[model samples]
Target: MLDQTRRGMAAFGLALMSGLAPVSAMAEDRPVIAAAADLKFALTEIAAAFAAETGTKVDLAFGSTGNFATQIREGAPYQMYMAADESYVAWLAAAGLTRDEGTLYAQGRIVMMVPHGSRLAADGSLETLRAALAAGNISHFAIANPEHAPYGRRAMEALRHQGIWEALGPFLVLGENVSQAAQFATSGDAEGGIIAYSLALSEQVSRLGSYQLIPADWHAPLNQRMVLLKSAGPVAEAFYVYIGTPAAREIMKKYGFGLPGE
Candidate 1:
């Protein structure tokens, strides 16, 4: 009986030690992620899920990819970068900021959104917008700054493709990033904004306004990519693998994003 008691006590002690172990001693760990602003909602949820499953935490910093790229070049301590466009990731790879081959994580679609109480029709096509502009109903339109945001560049491309760049040029209100552009639309600072469908599907925006998807063909595809930095730890690699799993892909789809392989 005494031997049995001793064995039980030893087992309990081992279990306690395991439970009390520091997170740094774990086989895989969490990584600091620098992500594009448009991915705020989706990536947060995904990060939480990844943490629950793998005991990995994702410390995320959300901003424009261009700015993040500049920071990374300046030696920001991020282990991974998720950009809203492939070009940004490619540029980082060229600059030796990350691994040469980055994974294409998701694709984004653009939309036009209006404020909660606005009576504006949900017509997002160029012709519809032209008519609204002619009527002087859309006083301010928000877009991300094209200098640093791929979505903004796409918005500009769409306007130019429709031959309305000069006509709509006067009403353009620029946000620092796509998420800010959505905020501009939601806060009524701008009557409408061209933003990512991902942001449009977010709970805050969905409750604050409605969106009409811009035609996919109007601009180049927004293929977002994620690259693991050379400085990435095992946790970062594990998280990267987690994102490509079926579970994460489902989460992305729920948030109005499409996976690359899909």
Candidate 2:
């Protein structure tokens, strides 16, 4: 069962591009939970702990919130959804797809990250980014597509607040989601980018680059929210409740998510 859970978790993040096949027939007993890409590391740890504590498992698929919203509306069989923005959950509720409006899970932030040898300064003010752009030292700057990902949308807002949105346009390279944005920022193809603070905190991404948090006031609040779909069952409900537990909240904090109400 542990092996199966690992496999399911591993495949969930890829389900978007795979046409949702990875989660198609994952154990009927293990409910599928669609999550925002920023929650990948934190929620993965939380789920493992939940499984260990309860002897039951849930599958989690991480991707762009807007894309997940579209999938849920299209009847994707997801029992739960954790969106990086509360608006998406509210939208699902309005569509009568979710059990309720949903619970506020966490608040998120963005950061500017640059790889080891980049000309960019990884400054939260984005002034350095503007300077790099003017100097032609920035080849490509990574960001998730603002059309779908909440973090991406916030990134765009922050850049706009910094007054560099237009000039940076010609050098932009978008990732499908924030996690992918982090990858691109640290990869040699791009000099740097704004990505989820949670992703930048992860060891896997941080090892390759340095990051600085953007000001919270620069963008609208990233009030993350989660909901149980109408298709949710007992296991999924338990997992949803478990996310509010102290253990889970700690994991979220460790991954750079600001806990709700705290």
Top TM-score prediction, candidate number: 2
List ranges where model 2 is wrong by over 4 Å: 1-28
- Backbone clash total for model 2 is 0
| TM-scores, one per candidate | 0.86, 0.89
The residue-level lDDT of candidate 1 at 216 comes to: 84
Compute the lDDT of residue 92 as modeled in candidate 2.
Answer: 90
TM-score of 2: 0.89
lDDT of 1 by residue, 42-161 (tens): 888887787677655768888898999889888998999999988888888988878766999899998888776664655568676777777887767777888889898898888888
Q: Rate the local accuracy (lDDT) of all candidates.
A: 0.77, 0.83
